[model samples]
Target: MNESRVVGQVRIVGAGLLGASIGLRLRAAGVDVIVDDSSPSNLNLAIDYGAGRAARDTDDPALIVVAVPPDVTAAVVATELTAYPDALVTDVASVKVAPLAELRAAGADTLRYIGSHPLAGRERGGAISARADLFIGRPWVVTPHDDIPTAQISIIEDLVLDLGAVPVIMSAEQHDSSVALVSHVPQVVSTLLAKQLLRSTEAAISLAGQGLRDTTRIASSDPELWVQILGANSADVVPILRDFRDDLDGLLTALAAPAVPGARRAVAEVLADGNAGVARIPGKHGQDRRFSQIVVMVDDRAGELARLLTEIGGIGVNMEDLRLEHSPGAQVGLAEISVLPEVEDRLIADLEAGGWKIAGAWR
Candidate 1:
């Protein structure tokens, strides 16, 4: 229970999705991970799910990740560091700049601390939805200060590596700004869009398609959690929202214009530019590469996907990703599996040979 000792243990100080996932991956890698949580039920559930053993007592952990809520991040990290002085403590808080500043204000050592945010999560929360591969092929951003030890930073990078995620280095300010652009702003927009439909007619809402669903999916996220995150990072997000509002005003003005030749073309050109901007987004794993999708027909019955996955396994094709979309009127659902362009033909042939139905493959 003393500092400057018990230096080989990996401790995860939250039993939520991110913390449990980290513990699960580290435990799978033969690393001894000890878990702690304010909620004893969540802590026990995480242990039951084989994430890690419950911490018998807090001591000098070798590496500690304080994966708590954004508002509590600084206070929790500061407390953990004080109690375990020799530990290299870090936090996976979504917003970094505020927490780092708060820790500094609390006189916590910056040498053994780093701020990290793994750009991955489920629509669901809690340890029940945790998975060991949650961070696999995801982007984990690390913000290391000038005073942070090189060895400590490397250890954090190594942890990201072991979790099968790509570690991207950024400063606290840069990380906050970039996340505001990509993650934080999108959540706010999605929530706003979903709120727009809250009072819509039942018929109009029922007629909604995949575009609406996809755009507003994140709006289903925990609103309370989002409030805390957005509140903490409001400095970075407000400017982005102002720019979005300007763009939206431009679109509204363009639509209000007449259907004259130049007027229509100008609006179309702006829409085309938006399309190009979207295409620039990395399809998966931030590889900056396009993916080819193959749509396969799957029945709605249980074990149907398991059977199809078995056939896919026999094909020896590596699938980059998968998305399931049920056809409204059809008896079958479309399973769009994304794979490397070169493997599409082989995947089709193998599935056909295995007596599995093929829908269509798109490049």
Candidate 2:
């Protein structure tokens, strides 16, 4: 069966979102999984959620996944390596170099361990927020050092594949620097921008739209946890933040006298640069091709979204992406569907013919 394709048993430590998600997916594949957490309640909650069973004394695992906070990841990995001498161990910490360095310093069996980071997560934490498909179609980086054997690396890749995530092999340093630019710095920027709302009047907030919501969606993440993550990866993050600061300073100067010579051009240059940078971000299925977006208005009621999806499937158009936005007090929600540019006109015509209100289409 499918269960025999992966490791026979997986022991998950730290029953947070990542750990519990791994457990849930593994259990679905019919693999034996046991979960543990520093918090008894968290462990019980994860088990209750059907992530996995409680750890038992006689349980032997072929693989162990450490899913703790960045600060304590090294200690836990070292401890796990010592305790389960026969098991392969990996961690899902955002920062990789620090933990690897710490583990090496502690004389842990580095050969039996590899560090990994799944470039996927919601703004929320905890097992209650976990989902079995959390890593599906997401990039999961497998950080391997020179000491690790090529054959042994497959152990982690097999798990990543089983969880439906794409495995990317790289050194720990490269992973740390890459995530600093993409993940860590973005978190800092979002949190700081969201903090500005504290002084905004209710009237000012009322005018907010999808742009504000999209940019600051991750600001809802826990502060204490982010502090641990940012601090752990500050070495790579600080340089990026400094560059951002320089850009902000230049923009502030240009805004100080917008009518001055070259001021408007400077602002335009900044915006154009942003357009070029964002376009570099890969689209659906890791392709760089941009899709045409069609905004369809739907009434805010049950079965409306499902009906739309069902109709789209019947139309035989492959949707590349979908996003929903609701006006603050409006009874209608906007469904932004992204499709291939070539099919945009036909799909829009068919959708309108089917009595769907077409808000707009960007071809």
Candidate 3:
């Protein structure tokens, strides 16, 4: 079936971030959306935000998207599949294997159900934080079982494309393992690092900088939700965590005996491995392109940053990324602008000619 025909009427079972985001995007595209949530307040908030209308008995949904929490995903998917027998059902829950297993155990129609996860979300939850562009340019994994018809998989892929997300096909087990490493493990690490701050002195926090903030930012995520996610994927996550713990132990041993033979080399090897791992990540738009960064020192006063950006724009070089850093009590801010390697020389030369001080450039 075609995209529009496949997704004529979408019923979203949860009205949280993923649910509301899906509703918003579908509604914006002029598709009919019906939203329902266990929480009446959340349902109302999603409706108020123009995500979708309340469900009615007469409405026969062509598609059902389960956006509920991980703990309730299987139950909700089963319910939705039973309620809308003709509709193609899918889910946005982060974990896949457990929910699919639960559905199978519940005797739900697995043939019509496709498991999917849009690898897009904010640290914050709820409809109030929903955005239409959340899934743009992100990987949306679709896990289809052996018994599922190819046509059913196509419908789900069409829906993913409708949200401007790229679809990656994987089995349930593959999806679970991939997210365990990329998403679940990072969240656990971030939370553990943030927990250390709770016991730290105010004087230590006063000296905190961007590195600390970046590492611990996701620690602000809802703990209860994470508990459910981690529990659901614990089988896949635990082994990775054990290996990570071994690495940490090695690092601690190195730190404890910095002057011991081979200890310093071990520490250096660990750091070098991190650099290699980071470099392996895909760059802008999932391409392998790496950009050169030029750091410009700007006055802390207002309008200075805007002036710098405007000057760079006038130089006819498109900046791929920008990061701003300011030291506490300092009168200057550092703006690191990333651009194509070929444009680095011209950009730096133009910026200097336009009376902007350049700190350095790195590839």
Candidate 4:
């Protein structure tokens, strides 16, 4: 393990969506990166998308990130370690415990190995979805074992930080358990809810609104990939699913007898609990709370967005994320801007005073 914080070279294996994105980020930050993928199509796509140059067998990379699926992550890491004996190795697989145990059982080199998971992704997959800034402001967990060298740990930390992510250090077991609650369990819940909607009548789904769409967004994720992630982390996931079932059973019982005081209280308490739980989730850029969403009606001309942005700048309230929804046959577009919750009213007042139409405002 080397203890130097400076990262020199990076090699990413797989050239899938995450791999390509990582390579692009490293290269954009002026770091040398080489990418390898077994699939020629994926490699070509990644290179065409400006990920990195195709990795050569002779190039001894300082850090290697394996972005393959969870099922194959262990074997791939083992082969990379053997191929590049001096390179520090890590993986972006969702589950860490199974692969770490596999590496031990297979007697692979553990000194250079660090387990990592970037808490970010889109519903879209493949190199086509690759973006250099995809990981910006996201949490990247680094799970290191006792046998790993300090140098290797530092290398992983620097690489993750350089990629514009916040590096969180934890043990492999702890990382897996934590994600099971936040990432894995929520994915399962979304899928289960989506499945219920799938079996419903067409009229039922047609009546669904934005709330349903928001809750079921993860259902659009790749089912095959999730199968591997959920299966690999089953040990941590099963207990969560069991507890979920117990809560769900209680909710269903409340629905069965709505007039019962105890059941009604339980249902109300669950909803209140959900409100509290949502308040605890870290907001954008890991802030404790999110700003209010303010909608502004924008004209659909070429310079309309620029004009709105300039107007916003004049108002002096810090703007957050922006979303645009174009209207059919209408001259205006719905521009949703996020601002500090307290500043929302001030922003609306300023924009409205400056001749900009205020569409709506919500927290």
Candidate 5:
């Protein structure tokens, strides 16, 4: 199917972050969207935010997207499949295997259903936080059953592309296992790390740095929602947790016996392994490209950062990534700009010639 052609109407079952985001993007693309939610306020908010309109009884959508909580995903999907018999159905729940299993056990129309998960979200939730570009440059995994028609799978893939997401096809088991390692385990670790701060002194928290903030940022996610997600995928998560526990035990043993023959080597190996693992993560949009970074010092005064950015634009060098860091009490901030390795030396020279203070550059 052509991507630019009209997709007709898309009915969304939930008005939360992912549903509203899909609505917003599809509406922006001139597709008719009807949004329904159990919460009246959320549906109204999504409508007011230009996501979509209220559903009508006579409306027959070509596609139905179920974005409700993981716990109720199976019920909602089953109901929608029965209600919209002609429309192809897909759900954006994080856990894939459990819901599909539930639908199979219930003897639902599994042939008309596909499972999908968009790897994009904010620390917050609800329609108010929805954006049309939420799924841009992100991977959207499509898990199609063996009995599903190829044409139906293509429709879902086209919908994913229309929402500005790259579609990656995988089986339900593979999808569940992958997210268990990458997404679920990280959330569990972050929440556990943040829990330690509950018993810390106020003075100690006041001394916390960006490292602490970065590590615990996702800990602010809704606990109830995570409880459901973690529970649904517990079978996959438990094995990963066991492996993690073993690594933690090894680290503790090394720390306790610092004087032992191989204790120092064990600690060093752990840190080195972490560095390698981080490097293995693909860059934006699963691109394997690596970038060189240049750090420029800018004053804290107004327009300084803007002036730096303007100067970089004038240099005709494209920046791949950017990070800003400010000292605790310093009047200066550091802006780290990432660019192609071949352009790093020339960019630094041009910036220096343009009177910008260069802090450092690294590959």
Candidate 6:
């Protein structure tokens, strides 16, 4: 948290993952955070965890954050605006366009409200999985509304910065469209792909590895929550999904005729296009750069991976990414650590010298 942007008080509605995480971070930064929830047990749990104390009628929050589900986001924001007349209200909902539209239709105090969506989360939910640093280095979108002044949005921007997130200003429409492609559609794709595994045999599923895990990990997310998100943004999400269906049809046709003329070329073109798409995605620190991976073999026991990481830290090499893979019947696991290309050879040299077995290294 930054001292200059130190807020006197923040009242967060909905003690779920986002709200509790915000409270945890703000409370740790010496800010007065009041966390409230419809479920008293959930509220008390967050309070007991020191995310924030129970709300008091005398509390005058400088800012209010509504972290409820997407379906009720607009209603909650409207209620917050009416209750906290002097406070600015923002939300952590996934969809922006519908909520803002609903607020306008209801004739709420629009000038004091802004819509926010932080592009960060895990497959899990609830306050138990919340962490103070969850939003660190993540993008938090602030939607532009006609009622709010350009200067008034700065308060929300400061709140984002104080949470260690990068503030990305976008219009409500742009935010909805962008997230449809990047987040909502991906959830649908992952869930549908994971559904295919339900019919697999034990032996077939035993052969699954990192690739399948990577592609379908988000399938574990709460379906109840995702239904609301996807439905709210379906206007933007459906068209992209239709495009994907067309591409898949072409791919399936090519795979069905691998020996036919031009079929192999069609398949190769699809794969090459996929490679290009991946290369366009930003890497570490949200920059377009390459990373080199160094896989180290570790005994599947306590402290082995810890020792490996401690030694990497001791060498002052920043790990851009990491992935762990362990087979059920194997005694050793592969720790794939990604670092800058420039440090690849030096890292392998240092690790091998330190008695660490190198499984592989590549860019």
lDDT of 6 by residue, 321-346 (tens): 99999888899999999999998999
RMSD of 6: 1.1
Report the C-alpha lDDT of model 4 over 196-263, residue by residue, as the tens digit. Answer: 98689987776765568678998999999999999998999999999999999999999899998798
Off by over 4 Å in 6: 1-4
Worst 10 residues of 3 by lDDT: 1-10
* Tens digits of lDDT, candidate 2, 288-354: 8888999999999999999999999999999899999987888999999999999999998899999
Clashing pairs in 1: none
lDDT on C-alpha atoms for all candidate structures = 0.86, 0.92, 0.91, 0.87, 0.92, 0.92
Candidate 6 residue pairs that clash: none
Using Cα atoms with residue i matched to residue i, what is each candidate's TM-score against the true structure? 0.90, 0.98, 0.94, 0.90, 0.95, 0.98
Q: Where does candidate 4 have its weakest 10-residue lDDT segment?
A: 1-10
Error of 2 at 10 (Å): 0.4
RMSD of candidates 1 onward, in order: 3.8, 1.2, 2.4, 3.4, 1.9, 1.1
- Residue pairs with backbone atoms closer than 3 Å in model 5 (clashes): none
Query: Per-residue error at 163 for model 1, in Å?
Result: 1.7
Scored against the true structure, residue 334 in model 5 reaches a CA lDDT of 88
Q: Put down candidate 3 lDDT per residue, 78-129, tens digits, no spaces.
A: 9888888899999999999999999989989999899999988999999999
